[model samples]
Target: MEIDYSQIKVIGFDADDTLWVNETYFRDAEIAFGKLLSEYETINKIDQELFKMEMQNLGIYGYGVKAFMLSMVESAMEISNNNVSIKTIQAILDIGKDMINKPVELLDGVETVLSTLSKKYRLILATKGDLLDQERKLEKSGLTDYFHHIEVLSDKKEKNYSRLLNHLDIKPSEFLMIGNSLKSDVLPLINIKAHAIHVPFHTTWAHEQVTEKETNGKAYKTLSSLKEVLNLIH
Candidate 1:
């Protein structure tokens, strides 16, 4: 089926994996965390429990490394029966700090794509994460000037997207979202009658993974690279 972008005046980009390296760091941190708690349980068990903890804590901690670090701490304590040492807890904090401090590495053709699209359309950043952390990354990325507006959302759901579009005075049909997460960036926008393009990253957080049933009959474009987006939009 053919999709139309002729009415799309505003384009929104997801920050994390869509524009730069993000989920990869979380994977690395998870591995380190597993090693730290290896004495309490097997690596596989630790990984599973940590993911469970993260899901349970999402509403409380929201998203970003700080939330993840707290989940790690909670999981460590639970798996160790509250016998985990302070040094290990400190190690978890250090892991998150290291992740936050890691340099932002933009994906291939990100700048070029943003630059090209900005010239032709209204580009806005619509990403969800810790405001300070997301702001820090945007500053570090050096791609801030390309966007007309930057929104760090608390969450990315149909309602959130609708609210954002309404605030921007944009109709759903006039907005397009580009991101890596099918759950956050693609499905929500599609639900609100907006256009979305999925650009999958190599590693994805378990929370962001969506089942086939959720995406059944969904109409969206999936491109292998950001460069391919130029073909779709204009």
Candidate 2:
């Protein structure tokens, strides 16, 4: 279905995978984590249990590398039956630090897209993660000047987006969200009567995956790259 962008006055972008490489590092860290715990369980089992632990602790630790690191430590202890070595725990911390400190690599056309879109509409970053970590990445990304506002949400549920839009004094019909996660970025906006465009990244965390049933009849546009967003909104 064709949608209208004529009413869009504020365009919000998801920071992590949508603007730069994020989940890839997390995947690499997960592989390293599985390798560290290989003695306790198979790599596959370790990966599964780690995901389970992350889901369980999401409420307590929230999102981002720090929370992920805590989940890794807890999962390792449980997997090893409290027999995990201190050395291995140290390795987990090292893995998270490595991820946190990795260079911020922007995806293709990110700067150009932001630069062009910012000139046309008020641009805001709407993303969820560790506040310090997200701020660090934004500082490193060199794209901070393009945004009119930056919001680091705790979660991207329907209520969260509604509250943010309301706080910003933006009407739902006048807001557009662009991101990779259909669950967090697209569906919620669509549910709240806001516009959304999906830009799929090569990798997505398991927690962000959603069932098709939840997306049935959802009205939104999906693009292959951030560059294509210009075609829709302009």
Q: Candidate 2 versus the native: TM-score? A: 0.99
| Residue range 125-165, candidate 2, lDDT tens digits | 99999999999999999999999999999999999999999
Off by over 4 Å in 2: none
Q: Which residue pairs collide, candidate 1?
A: none
Q: Give residue 182's error in model 1 in angstroms.
A: 0.8
* Worst ten in a row by lDDT for model 2: 111-120
What are the lDDT figures for the candidates, one per model?
Answer: 0.95, 0.96
Q: Indicate the TM-score of model 1.
A: 0.98
Clashes of each: 0, 0
Residue 23 miss distance in model 2 (angstroms) = 0.3
Best by TM-score: 2
Superposed Cα RMSD, model 1: 0.8
